[model samples]
Target: MPLTLPLAELEVGKHLYWQLGNLKIHGQVFLSSWVVIGALLALVVVGTRKLERDPRGTQNLLEFVWDYIRDLSREQIGEKAYRDWMPFIGTLFLFIFVSNWGGALVPWKLIHLPSGELGAPTADINTTIALALLVSLAYFYAGLSRKGLRYFEYYVEPTPIMLPFKIVEDFTKPLSLSFRLFGNILADELVVAVLAFLVPLIVPLPAMFLGLFTSAIQALIFATLAAYYIGEAVHEEHH
Candidate 1:
């Protein structure tokens, strides 16, 4: 018999579905997503349960993460409106970061799913597309809420020649964001699975670490761009 690696399968194209009155849902994705979200909630609850002035343990970690997110949102969204959107931006950052990390770190093989195996939520196109759409919505909302009907003027500012291009940009933006995230994460997971199959020991460690790093970077990029888009929408031009 030849060598066999069960994990090499990785279940890339397979999706587990949940039935709901003729509506089919990606059950695995939602299951994994809930796991990721639950973990974040648990962390927050545990971390803040015993808050101390001179923090230690989980509190310190939460404080560090909180401060990092605050700075990141403030830097991109600016001082004036950053606070208003910090929670949204921070949620995106944490959700993606944890989801990516969970997919890579968790040994889903050990946990039995109803159908297919679970992987990173980001690896799914639907998840990324949903996230990108949310960002796009945030951009429009930020502009409209702050500037009212005048927000449409952004397309024609500096010159009317830019109107068509700006309109096209709205469509392209979400496509770019979703595909970039989905491709990178899915590719990363597949590569690691292959490496683990070939070497099965020391070789996959480096790739795993790299995956974690890249996942974090992707999350940061998504959150930063989201903040920037919102910031640009709400920006005032001084003539």
Candidate 2:
């Protein structure tokens, strides 16, 4: 017998929506992404306001995260560029990390809208692609800023003989980054959805735990690669 896969029909407007009109203040609408961004912004604001020298509560937790990312940057990119890249890397890690895990905890199903409901922003292709683009832009800018006109030299590295390969390698970075994140998040969502359908209860508990782990790892990988790209863009030829 052929195995039958469960198909859930997700109506575009019901699960996702976009508004178009002159009356719209925002050009494109994405409630899920907006909510994720809003939550991150709120965390930043509250964390900063609550900062204490002798850290306690949320301040202590934020400091721990900051320290962890700072160390990660130093390990992957080295101390020279780590300081400059810390803020961006730290923000990326925390934002993506939170967004991924938050998807599991948020009462998305409990709250009903005209559309289906909110899912993890990072789980969406558009959101992951946007992140990849941002990372690309960051490293491109870093290259230009660090090496001036010579930044293009990376595309012709080893020798002019190797230009084609170098260019191909450079171009693949963003594509790999985008797809890796998209694939992992998409897989996690699918697993959760399928398990919820088939087992519906006790069986999904293990999958949920696994999903949480996968989510954190995906965030870390993205941030690590981002830091690595920035490091390569700025590093001296010998280093």
Candidate 3:
């Protein structure tokens, strides 16, 4: 008997895996990812080419987004260090935001792949895990770079009783981030796929809209948490 994943074969990028050397790559995931990234780059180029004083069209939208990101980072990471990390946090938020909306709106599944279907990159567990690991690394870098050897003092702050829990938290943080994102995205795709497959018209519309809202929320939540983690690492209590 052949094994099968429940409700995954017909929806999103879960049909099969592409083997590339030692790595198990999903062709659809990368395909959509590159497409979305390319579009974003093109927008950046077009938006910056003119640079008018009033900031019209794409420039205005870009500036608005930039300011929002800046404010969010500042609120979470504090004034001193937020400027340095804003770009990273902004990129993470934008990528996830676009990817999620793309999955819900773009008919990527219409573009047939040799193995799997194209969905949001975040819908892939591997992509989410990679992103979560990057956040983990970013916080570690933030802590070590700002505090040097003193960063270790975080684990025992207040008292030594938090040492074990703090150590466990390091492992759990990445796991939580990855699974939460992957699960939410996959579930969104799943519901939309099932509705479209079954009703194929008006039934899926509501689900699709809900998916977009949830997608944005997920991106915001992920970015906020990431900035908070970095902020915590870099914050000094000043005793």
Candidate 4:
């Protein structure tokens, strides 16, 4: 007799491919991402459509979320610079938070694909790396734009001896950021799938709950770090 594994085992590393002219892309990631984006936009639209002195329903929720993201940015990026970058930071947080939770909670497996099934966009290495690279670009742009040529002086701040490490940090920042999010999300999904495969019922519930919690935390951490990086770049040095 041959042993067979159940579908509950889950496909860990597969992607739905779409050909766009000559370039191939992950279809499922985009599909799920679009869903998340649409949901976020709809929420924003509905929430802001009617603004009142006394917030109600979705408006109240929206205001609370806005305040939370604002505070996070203000605390990390400072009052002067935080306002300029709050939208970017908030978008990152909301997008990642939705992607992570949606991937975990939604029954994506119900919607089958030719190759890969739908999951969190963040679970994909390409998506996380792209986001990480964007953050890297943002900080560099922020520094140079705000400080002009003086931004290069950051490499030597505290002491010229720090130049080598600062240069290396530029490379490490994105690498660390991308891998951290990617690894955590991938691990969480895999853990839940494996537990489901083994027990097929009640056992996976706890892991699923924990995954949701971690998902939210990861979003917050990513946003906070992004804001902090920008703040550090634009921070003034006093004589």
Candidate 5:
């Protein structure tokens, strides 16, 4: 009998082939991050198309998520800023929460595709980096919109001596955000793989449950920090 590895351990480079040309796309393109993002956007659009004052079914579920995210924003960023940032914050939370859970629940190993496995979009580093960039840009735009030219003044605030450290701090936010998510999800996936490999029967069950908890916590942490960054960007300094 050959050694069988879990889907989590499978590498795309070995299972999928890519053509090298100006217009050539990889065989795994369908399973790529863009496809997942498109699917998420489509769901959001379809769910919102037939809105009702009294929501039901998918609409109710969407509304529930929205309310949860709104509450999170209000608590973390305050009411005045929460309304303005709700859509961005809400979208981030929904996308991450869905992606994390979906990845764990989906039977990527059972499906045979060009890609090695059909894991969640959030499992990809590119996807996480893109999300972090969006968060960084959101805060940048919020800061600019709120403070105009004064946004630049934030760096030199308290004292000119703190300028260099403040500048570095600003630059590190996105990097930290991107890596924190990527590292946690990757580790979770790896643990799942190792456990499944060593004991295929029932040993991996506990780890799966733990992974779900960790995934939710990571998503919440990411969204909370994002809200905090946006709040910091737009907050007025006390004299």
Candidate 6:
């Protein structure tokens, strides 16, 4: 008898489609996203249920995360404006962190879908683009609301020659942000999947651990960049 290995079946670009009138959506992505959202909401609820000067258990963890996020926003957006944007930045970080970790840690493969498999929402193009677009809108709103009509001056303040590039940047910013997160997450998932298929045992453990670390890092990176963008928009240019 000859020994043979089963071929790994990788699923890519496959979406569990849902149709609503003229609109089409990815059901799997939304399903996973809801799971992530539910997890976050549960943690928040439990953590805030009992407020105390001396935190314990889930409250302590929540407070640590909150303080860390606050510090990050303050460092990027400055103390004057960080408080206003802390919620937005913190939500982004927590959502992404949970999504990434859940994708890796959850036994999503056990749940069989008709089309696409369940995974991290961030790994999807639509989700990342939506998040990136939100960041873009946040900065634009921050700038226009804070500076009024004078916000347009940012396009040419450094020099008139910089106007064109600055205008182009508005488009590039969201594009880069969306693609960066989407590519990194999707690539990570694919890499881990391929490794698991090839080894099917002890070999994939290291890759799984590394994926967890990168997932957390990506969440931090996305949140930091979002805060930085908002900070730049609201920054007071000293002449």
Between candidates 2 and 3, name the one with more favorable lDDT.
Answer: 3
Misplaced by over 4 Å in model 3 are 1-19
**Local error of candidate 5 at residue 42 (angstroms):** 6.5
Q: How much does candidate 6 score in TM-score?
A: 0.95
**Clashing residue pairs, backbone N/CA/C < 3 A, model 3:** none
lDDT of 1 by residue, 114-225 (tens): 6677999999999999999999999999999989999988889879999999999999989988998899899888888889877989999999999999999999999999
Where in model 1 is the C-alpha error above 4 Å? 1-8
Q: Once superposed on the true structure, which residue ranges of model 5 sit more than 4 Å away at CA? A: 1-9, 12-50
Could you tell me the TM-score of candidate 5?
Answer: 0.83
What ranges in model 6 sit over 4 Å off? 1-8
Instruction: Report the lDDT tens digits of candidate 6 across residue range 1-239.
Output: 27544432567888999998999999999999999999999999999999999998899999999999999999999978888899999999999999999999999999999998999999999999999999999999988998997988888878989999988999999999889888888888988898888888988898888899999999999999999999999888999
lDDT of each: 0.91, 0.77, 0.90, 0.91, 0.78, 0.92
For 104-209, candidate 5 gives per-residue lDDT tens digits of 7766677777555666667767677888999989988988998898987888888899899988987798889888887887778778877887888789999999
lDDT score, residue 180, model 4?
A: 93
Per-residue accuracy of model 4 over 88-127 as CA lDDT, tens digit each: 9999999999999999999887897888789999999999
Global CA lDDT of candidate 3, please?
0.90
The estimated TM-scores of all candidates read 0.93, 0.86, 0.93, 0.96, 0.83, 0.95
lDDT of 5 at 148: 96
- Model 2: lowest-lDDT 10 consecutive positions: 20-29
Clashing pairs in 6: none
lDDT of model number 2: 0.77
Q: Taking the candidates one at a time, how many backbone clashes does each contain? A: 0, 1, 0, 0, 0, 0
The TM-score obtained by model 1 is: 0.93
